[model samples]
Target: MEFKRTNMCGELRSQDIGKSVVLMGWVGKKRNLGSLVFIDLRDKTGITQIVVREEDKDNYKKAREISQEYVIEVKGSVRERESKNSEIPTGDIEIVADKINILDSANTPPIYIKDDDDVSENLKLKYRYLDMRKPSVQKNLKLRSDIIRTAREYMYEHGFTEVETPFLTKPTPEGARDYVVPSRINEGKFYALPQSPQLLKQILMIGSLDRYFQVVKCFRDEDLRANRQPEFTQLDLEMSFANQDDVIEMNEGLIKELFDKYTDYDLELPIARMDYKEAMDSYGSDKPDLRYGYKIQNVSEIFKDSDFKVFSDNTLEGRSVRAINFKNLADKYSRKQLDKLTDFVKDYGLKGLSYIKYQEEIQSSIKKFLTDDILEKLKEALNLEDNDLVLIGADKDKTVLEGMGALRRKVAKDNDLYEKEYALCWVVNFPMFEYSEEEGRYVSQHHPFTMPNEEDIDLLLTEPGKVRTQAYDIVINGDEMGGGSVRINNSDLQEKVFEALNLTEEDIKNKFGFFIEALKYGTPPHAGLAYGLDRLIMLFAKTENIKDVIAFPKTQSATCPLSEAPSPIDDRALNELSIKLDKE
Candidate 1:
């Protein structure tokens, strides 16, 4: 018999009543009585109920034999369901089967094919093809597609040309480690996957592409975390003769469109901006969630003259104290719970945690150490009220901010303190260089090509640590959604940035030789940004697990459960590539 789908299972509704429709999908489930059978047919869109009555003997017989996940085609007339299911989209209508074709049968699946199945991630990933059939999973993938299409369409309308850069390119000097592929004919040489197309995009600007964009794959052979993968997609973009303002302006439209299309919040254009230093000082995070009002407050002055040595010592130069008020959560946290909070900050390098319970009677961890005068001052600084809990961290500025910032976020999450669903802002004016303690040198905060602020350019060599870059990041709900910086178009300035990193002439020639050469060929003042496509989708999809947004994501250990990827290659294939395993 000929098989063709006249309509999707989920799209049929009461309006299509009495219309003959051909539907092909997997059997979501089957309910069989002695006379009748009701089967829920599922496609990627959704599930629709199909009724096979005893009167239609042949169809009823075939439907009765159907089991879960069995692929089948049905010829039926749409009819209003007497019993409506408010839960599903196609609940109002169902097909009354006249003909049925059981195309294939499926054995019991390893995992249930349903949303909210609550199976372990490994099992879901192992049977990813089946997992994707779930409506919830399919919706995320669909949203991912919509976002990419929106981005592409926006770029095209804005005169940006989509260009495909090579996947196998030279490794960059800055950022994460690269995933390298060994070359067969080139003996020991290898090709490192492009980390961000950072150099290539700038080279395009030099080549006068003017406006370039790529939905590119980037690989990083670094330690994987929950949201991070060994390989990920980047919405890579760059523009020539553009500054930070131009880049941000153009991107704001696309970002606004995405938010406006996907979210209910009315996002205002030219989204608010916060300086990097201000963000760190105010929230202890470069990417701060502005949805709530637990802003980090500097309380160093409150303990400046205190007898407590810990508070006084940190209140000195290069050290400081900070605090956050968990509004009305004081009595809620017991001593043991407070101890747990203390244990949490230890990972951030705090020796201890100090907190105040501003209840009927003011109680504090440092009650014995501080005079009542200092306590009063601290209360004033944090705007103390009844039932308030103030958590304080005192150390060097970096340690205090980071520790307190982390505590701030943790408290908000633990106590259900988030006031809004989405909070976004532009974090601008990042430091040009950050000192890497392990490397014992300054590295680019964004990348080597980042152009320093006009005034800060003079401070680049003299006060490299203080120099600010013309860089910006679009931070959404405390995640760095996307970031970019103006490129150092002049070859001499580019070489100087390398010099500031203490790179030897040989290091410069080998690592960035081609990029430096490209800069010499009339490079334009270009800037670009790349969004973590997966993270963006995860945010809009409202899923905390990044794997929820990816189709076949790898585990935190960077291995794919579906294909058993990273499996060993045959020894003959290894030999052909001139590779040998040390296994040491």
Candidate 2:
């Protein structure tokens, strides 16, 4: 209390021996070793050992009372430790105290402050403050800040203007459900949080802002997952008078900057590009993980004339059979394991799985149905080698792709076939519209603003499903980190695209009327991308759980355990908002 801290706990080394220092931090751990009391003092930087000798009776007594996470201040002289720790940066030195002060007392933490703690995720989110004390968690938070800072610097250097858009905006009919906020002032009106700054950013381009970027918060009331959140951050950017390649090159430079600064791996210029169809056909994903070699092969030709009903039936009418040769893993899987894999793909909506195993003998689930000629043809087509295990699935075109695509990734992961490195690429030329059974109409695959490819323009009306947009997604190791597309500069083209989406006059007028108005006013050819900031941080932080990179994240149910949000509001507040609870 009497002196301000002069040094961080982690900054001290053996060179600072005998240097009197004032250190203040939380007591990470306290140990009473009979003759000496040792405390591990922690701050955001790191941790340092604090020792109070029995001879320093007053300080020793004070140190004895310090428990884990108790706030403390130590006026100590840097001294060599009797034992040196190799694991920590400040491990080689110790702080021998002249005084030990308990700045603040603490209650026991509900969760352990260690990274390897086997606590439930709900409990961890509930006590996120305590969870953040873990060195790994703190490192993630710090890395997140550093990433944003670097992004701003790179964008500024590249002549991109950072802008902020409104959080409370109109609800769009397309995309994810909006998290709506009722307006108290307006009788029954509501404001939906921005899903992305998609429309406004284009309007910025229309307003002649050459290039714009925003490190903004966007919300969607979507189902939660390990890699998704209801509220997430995006590095949104747009460029006026830019084509697909122009936007790609500019963003590629930004990505190179971030990767070059943060990661050790050298990122080669001009990330590889792939078409939507190629990615789907070869890897079963739009964002394919190219680090490993289990590329999917279409075996429909060989299976078409076979007696196997599953394959023969699927190979008809534009549907086809697909297989992935998980090389040299034939012997690794038991019959039970293969059955489990079948169940796994079923979750992706496939009826079942068929597999051909080449362990010691050539065997398959449909081996009985295979003629010698057909078997030989299948082997030749797939280029099957010794010890190759071929996973086969068949269904409708879309179902087969989704199921087999998931299977490919699952197999690769289970076998450790992929490296944990960034394999970045641009998945380009996506479909302009995809059919939505729930809506019973076509919906914009990206958004209605996306410009269809010039070559595909005529197909917009007659063969709407065949139209490809100039959209592209930056995929890293099979994760869609960010994506955007060339905008529909012409108002007529935008209307046609909406019509293809089956949006009636009322739907268009209600949802995108203002955005439609903006398109009429000299909008330029533009393309942009919004990187999922949480996913980006995950790659940098080496964390798969989206919650790890976030300071306070909600559970899978989209509830914040720490603050108990979405709880019952008082009747008075509800009445002010002109809302009433529907208690059934």
Candidate 3:
């Protein structure tokens, strides 16, 4: 390119007419229209039209030869387009080229450089550099940046100091498996990537950083889903002298501000709060999508007296009876289709699914076992109408909720019952500890640092099943966008919590000794939340895949196609760390 680029592809307008300007970008589209050669130049901002006329014979010939995505710089005079293209931002303006210089040429991209391009995910990921050229991809990145900026600004306004915690730290055993970094200096001592800055942030609070915030990176070597990534960013925050309500209110302001700035939809303030039990009972999901009307109803009372063995057998003790009426779905599903759904919930440990169809007359396989009064009562409890399908899950309390939860989401999605407009809610009062049969012990549902509700402390020891913690999750449209809890400030409560989780004194000392020591040094009652910024951005961008919002994201197997990570380290490098590969 002979001349320096002066204007962005999207910045030129009629007001700049006749002004000499230089523009550089990839060729969006090129065509030879009679005597004039037209080229659409595209950059991250947008696209602009450039015209090389026969009057400028040299430039016209040069422009006619360039293909899409060819890098070029053009020196021209900005002019009002003779034929306006109303579709683009710079449609009314055009550049009449006097000089054209091709900087680089390109082969055709594997994926289309448009938002609505239909290409396999593998191809898109393989050529991510080219795929990110689309205007939508650029906008997603910008939107993500804006959200992070707004969060930082909000935290600063509320007297929060941004802090950076160590990425390579000692591994804590409670959470997901960590990606370990071998240490050369300290042989046999490995540094594990921080799953979260949970401990360090608390230590920061104790160190008298009253309000601390960090837009930080966190790593978890875990199984991936559409929303999960190996390496993800989080808006990690913590505050001293702040309770659960204080943390919630501060974040609510940040959320509202982000939505108000980035979207046209107004966020409902003081978003609806549901206790964990309520969320489980009514919506069958912790992160409930409250857009539609498919609430899970407890039908135990209706079937308690019924002769149906399925319902009666499951309700012996630690079991539940739950049903979801997908209103008017009898015609939408068949026996085979229902069978597929049964298999879907089975992944979540559900034994089987029992369903009844309500048409002009009552119809069900189990109807024969029920008397007329019992059938009427069942219909009344489920609020059944003609063509309604009442899907039932009778199992242990956990499996019933899990099965119905999965079914509720599946039905809502298939029926197009979801509202695109966001619905935000806080799912609160989570169980402090959940019994982990595999581990043969109770484990902290949130984290060991979480404070139990004051009144529930007694039950934490005796009736552990009934205890609730001061934990809350910011659930947006069936996704857990973020979650946190008030920390146990008192030493006694913290000790009891650790004991309940079956962590011995030695185990606690080894794992969280520093944290326990910090709590004794006048630690203020604090609470914090970490937002999965990538997931949050994905939701706001109306994308279901987290990879779409993330630049150069890894695959479901946590492999980066672009970089091909988890590659074999050189023998010399491994030898320095005193490690050797022993493959089977």
Candidate 4:
């Protein structure tokens, strides 16, 4: 009998044994014995077994001809499996086939449609359509979609209107390079793809779109890393008449809901809060992963009067000394391995890294140079134990924090100290400005539009580095999941910010004159945050590679192998835009 699919392949079980059903999917596998044939029908929902008996002559013969990936519709009745395959979710039931219809025939796929297939990324990308047939990839995409849906619903419930900002806008100098689009109408001019809807969202507050949010596409022309892509999606949001605390509370509810609904883990709301200075001093990272406990310890005071010149010199320069006490990892890493770790911190501009491994006899690099009193004090200060490995970095305060911060993570990973779970930390109290020695000026750490902490306004020009901003970042497992700041609303305060950044009158007029004009017409006190949606999905799906989350991700070189984008355009089209190609 011919039949339309009444149920998905995996939806049936032993309870539906006598119920007639039709199942349709690609043939995941096929096996033929002397007189009988068995096939596994696979779909996004799951897999089910189909059996054809020799007595059904024509149907049994047709099943013999079926191969992997052949799309077929099977009319059958569910039955208990003779041999239960406990590995799969629906392994207890089998579908006894009565008839089969081949819907579509497929060539043998270049890559296997199974997880743990050892195919090259290039091959997988080239045959991405076939590759996505794998259950693992499908599951990841579904999880990502669900996460976005939950986020949207949560925002709507909390009074946010989804609004889309423009894709093309003016290029600002501070952020990463922009992906520019050529203009035929304005021949020599170009429009830039937004790095984020930074300026536009702020302008919306002036326009009274009070609470706005968008799950939007953002672009940046930058080198890619394992978890970064040139074109990415962001959960962009802005709110009027809200302070840092207000934004934080709303986001906490959304995030806690996300974790509770999506995974088996229960994420604690009102998650632990860490300040910028505390995070840097303790972890050397703004986004500290709290799953592990190897917090950095300051040893500058204990090492100040030491005979070791490196420690003493660092202190004299107004820099600092710090260490991560890898409690039991001293036995795990050998001497040669420790030297390699020393070489690693040099990349972060630290002059050197020193370590002391406490054993039956305390082992160290500068052991001979240390007096008993100094050595004892150093050990006491660090709370060192017999099996602890102490890794130290010293230089400028910033360099010490940055270098050791990274070393702590490296050691944790090497020793398997990570919890393999989520820990969200809201890092706040970020300094509003950072001094640039090259430019001989101060630059906004977040952006110029970010308001400075009210009490610090007097020091904007005189002590720019000391001024903190009302900015916050939602960090999860060591990655900044989202960040934003309470924006500058008062026109006079905005000008004062520009002045502190060493922007001349001409510089201000050229880049952000229009934004200042918008502020004059009554802007509301507003704030918002944007989450790296792709990165958030990566976290929720527990995927290390960003490409796994994106459907048609570009390679590190920013070229799309599947569609062959960024290829040479037609000569006529290039000429129409009056473009020229330069060759070396």
lDDT string, candidate 3, 1-584, tens digits: 68877989989888888899999999988888888888999998899998888887778778777998999999888888888988998999998888999999999877788988998887788888998999988999989988888888888989999999998898897479999999999999999899999999988988999899999999998899998999999999998999889989999998899888878988988888999999888887788888787888888877776688778777765577888888888888888998898899899898888878889776665768767786688678877788999888888877788779888998888889876678889999998878888999888888888888889998877887678989999998889999998988889888887778778889988888888888888987788999999998998898998988898898888887777776998899989999988987
List TM-score per model, in order: 0.98, 0.98, 0.96, 0.97
Worst 10 residues of 3 by lDDT: 361-370
Can you write out model 4's per-residue Cα lDDT over 1-584, one digit (the tens) per residue?
A: 25767998778877888888899999999988867788999998899999999899888878988889999999888889999998887799998888888888889888899988999988888888888888888898888889999999999999899988888788776467989988888897888899998889999989999999999999989999988899999999999999999999999999889888877988877878899999998889998989898888888887888888899888888989888888887888888998898899998889898888878888888777667777688678777778888888889988878888888888888778987677789998899988889888888888899988889999997899899989999999999999999999999999999999989888988788888889999999999999999998998888889989888888888888789888888879888888988866
Q: Tell me the number of clashing residue pairs for each predicted model.
A: 0, 0, 0, 0
Which residue pairs in candidate 2 have backbone atoms (N, alpha carbon, C) closer than 3 angstroms, thus clashing?
none
List ranges where model 3 is wrong by over 4 Å: none
Segments in model 2 whose C-alpha atoms lie over 4 Å from true places = none
lDDT of each: 0.88, 0.88, 0.87, 0.88
For TM-score, candidate 1 versus 4, the one ahead is: 1
How far does residue 25 in candidate 4 sit from its true spot (Å)? 1.4
Better candidate number, 1 or 3, judged by lDDT: 1
Q: Distance from true position, residue 63, model 1, in Å? A: 1.6
Top lDDT hit: 2
lDDT tens readout by residue for model 1, 394-434: 89888888998899888888988899988889999999899
Candidate 1 clash figure, as a count: 0
Where is model 4 more than 4 Å wrong at Cα? Answer: 1-3
